[model samples]
Target: MLLGYLLEIVKDRDKAEEHLVSIFETIPQHIDRITGDGVNTWCELQRLARTYLAGTMYADTTSEAKFPNTANKFSALMNDEQHAVFCSIYYYGKTTAQLAQELGKTEDLIRKALREAFAIIRKAS
Candidate 1:
């Protein structure tokens, strides 16, 4: 399921392979901080792949006409911390706890960062 979803989003086989390699290397360390051994990482990957595909499809379909200049405006408005947190969670699949540990911040702080990042991204669209 995850492979199919990733293929849909990435389209190119080389890119999909690269994504898989990156995810495989990163997910274990990130997930280990939030979950004990025996967690189903494969399922988590599937969920992420599905989510990314859905979001990409939605944005591609709706954003062009709704907000023509949103990409540049939002990129300029995003704070470094917010962007880092967003990438850690969305692109690298880190949980709040994992992100907190990496940043030496509390879980609450990581969650706040994620919320702020999402708010900016949402407003841009």
Candidate 2:
């Protein structure tokens, strides 16, 4: 499922698989933290994957090179703010608290945005 999400962002099967590998590669180092009491394991893993993918997005050195095929069907359904929150969390690995501070909104509002964004994705899918 996570790979499916990444595929939509990168629009490259090989790169998406590579990103999946990168996420799994950190499992040994992050196992304790991810499996800590009260921690949501899946969410932690998703955050790790998103952070890794964000690095790729930011590090794409060719400024003139466009990211081709970026808008898959589901992504097209997202509004600007929904896209912003979704990308910040799922692509940029930002936490709700971090996004709240950055966007000058309450954490609750950030979370609500994320929830709504996910709902949009779900409906589109």
Identify the leading candidate in terms of TM-score: 2
- Which digits, one per residue and each the tens of the lDDT, describe model 1 over residues 1-125? 44444443456668777666665665565575336477676666665453444444322322123222222355456687776676555544457886788788999988898889879978988
- Locate the minimum summed-lDDT window of 10 residues in model 2: 59-68
**What C-alpha lDDT values do all the predictions have?**
0.58, 0.71
How many residue-pair clashes does candidate 1 contain? 0
Locate the minimum summed-lDDT window of 10 residues in model 1.
61-70
Give stretches of model 1 more than 4 Å off: 1-13, 17-76
Query: Which regions of candidate 2 deviate over 4 angstroms?
Result: 58-78, 94-112, 115-125
lDDT of 2 by residue, 21-56 (tens): 888888898899889999998888877776676667
Candidate 2 residue 52 Cα shift, in angstroms, is: 1.8
TM-score per candidate: 0.47, 0.60
